[model samples]
Target: MTDASGRIALLRATIVVVAAGGLRALTYRAVAAEAGVSHGLVRHHFGTRDQLVAEAMEFAIDESLRGSNMLEQGLTASEFAAGIESLADRESALQSFQYELLLESRRRPELTPLAERHYGAYREAIERQLGRLGVADPALVDLIWFALDGLVFTQLVAPADPAPALARIRSLVESAAA
Candidate 1:
């Protein structure tokens, strides 16, 4: 395959794998079967399962980044609530992919460091926002982090809407600040 064809192939395979959800032990054969391509083609682009997963996870992250423009500006209290809403939408697309990556990382310790790095960037962004607000409570910041994770999980699992949760968090943060 040409370079463009190879990238399109991987992109299609990634979409299938993500839609399949939590395919922890998925092989190149599985991906190739889904993509209707030869197994060798899958292996050609992603040499190992880890490499495939990494690329898939990166694809999900890139999708998540699509809606983060609102956060580029310094987030005020209300703006932060909107950011959470945007992020919840983003997380919904990639939650299963994230879950599988984390589970797979247990056996493949090499991937653990990459996970940490991804999570560290998440924490740092939150910390930077808190710093902008002049909040000194590391404990509170941790609570917000936990709350955000819970929000993502809730949005993923429950049938309820996220607007109420987002509103409640906004109120909580505003009240705490006041």
Candidate 2:
């Protein structure tokens, strides 16, 4: 396969690994079986279980940012807020998987650096967008992040309709920017 194909295959495998949540703790054999790829292929690309987990997490965050690229495209404040709300709604599974990875990262400090890197990338993206809109309130961003984290937690546990909560959050963000 070409390099692009290999990268795509690895990313697809990472998606499966993220979705499998606790199965990653079992074995690469299990993940390969679930991803419908050979165990050798999984090992060849990742080298070790810790590397695989970290790459899986990074892939997830990249996929999510790609899914929510409106901010990069120069959306208005309200539009960015709405886009984020919609992205959260659409990427709820990815967010839940991230929380699972967070739990794993606690036990596997090797993964923490990668996790922190992905999170910092996300925060930087948000900060860049806010700066473009002349919204320099770090406290507001922190509050939004706190609220977003709480919403993700609640959604993972109870699986509510996110629209109402998201609209409220968007309104709050918009108000802050006003």
Off by over 4 Å in 1: 1-12, 18-21, 33-38, 69-71, 86-91, 175-178
lDDT of 2 at 109: 84
What local lDDT does model 1 show for residue 116? Answer: 70
Measured against the true structure, the TM-scores of the candidates, in listed sequence, are: 0.72, 0.84
Number of the predicted model whose lDDT against the real structure is largest? 2
Candidate 2 residue-wise lDDT, 62-122, digit = tens: 8777787434856787887877654446776577667777777789887688768766767
TM-score of 2: 0.84
Instruction: Give the count of colliding residue pairs in each prediction.
Output: 0, 0
Stretches > 4 Å off in candidate 2: 21-26, 86-88
lDDT of 2 at 95: 71
TM-score of 1: 0.72
- Alpha-carbon RMSD, candidate 2: 2.3
